[model samples]
Target: MDVAAIVTAILARQAVRDPATLRPGMRLDDLGIDSLGRVEVVFAIEEQFDLSVPFNANTPDAGGFDLTSVGSVIAAVEALLGEGRG
Candidate 1:
């Protein structure tokens, strides 16, 4: 599946508010997703694209790993896929 579909499915599985209702700058707290939910989303994305994303306690604070919004997550996944393909 494509990034958007994978993202949508991730949100759906988490019972998050519809991604259609989300925007790029929205905050994760606004969507009711805690840190655990963020990790779940990350794992789901890895499984969806068969790509492994590096992580550490500071990972989310680093660039492109932020899951504050659906669009951000999609963009991050796209970047990771591009890196893997390269």
Candidate 2:
């Protein structure tokens, strides 16, 4: 599946708004996603990709991937999948 489209769908669900508004450069905070929302997004991504996404809901950078922006999340997923780890 297209990663961006999947992520956009997930974020749009959380946003409860139009998915078209989400941009690659938009940060999670800019997308209005809080800590709890972030966790949900991660969960969706993991389930969609059928791969475990490393994410620290308590401390974002402790032992996980980056969730800075939509593009970043997409990149991380691509990297993992490319490495055959996902």
Candidate 3:
């Protein structure tokens, strides 16, 4: 699966924005993703990738996963998938 495409789609749904308009550097806040939306995004990603995402809605940075931007999410998911293979 295309990590970027999936992540972008999820973000677009939560942010109510167009997937084509979402850039790699765009922050989740910039996309208007609230706390609940953030949690939903994480859940969707976990289901889509069939892998666990180390995310805590309360302390987002406490988890190893990076949710800084669109690119960071893609990178984190890719890294997690690589770890699963290893």
TM-scores, all candidates, are 0.76, 0.86, 0.92
Task: Give the better candidate number (1 or 3) by lDDT.
Answer: 3
* Error at 85, model 2, angstroms: 6.4
Highest TM-score scorer? 3
Write one digit per residue (lDDT tens) for candidate 2, span 10-82.
Answer: 8888877688988888888887888888899889888888877777777788754888888887888887777
Model 2 gets an lDDT of 0.81
The residue-by-residue lDDT of candidate 3 on 12-64, one tens digit each, is 98898889999999998888887788899889999998999999888889988
Worst 10 residues of 3 by lDDT: 29-38
Q: Model 2, 13: alpha-carbon shift in Å?
A: 1.3
**Higher-TM-score candidate among 1 and 3?**
3
Better of 1 and 2 by lDDT: 2
Q: Candidate 2 regions off by >4 Å?
A: none
Highest lDDT: which candidate? 3
Residue 47's C-alpha lDDT in candidate 2?
A: 85
Q: Candidate 3, clashing residue pairs?
A: none
What's the residue-level lDDT of 13 in candidate 1? Answer: 65
Which rank order by lDDT, best down to worst?
Answer: 3, 2, 1
What local lDDT does model 1 show for residue 68?
64
Clashes of each: 0, 0, 0
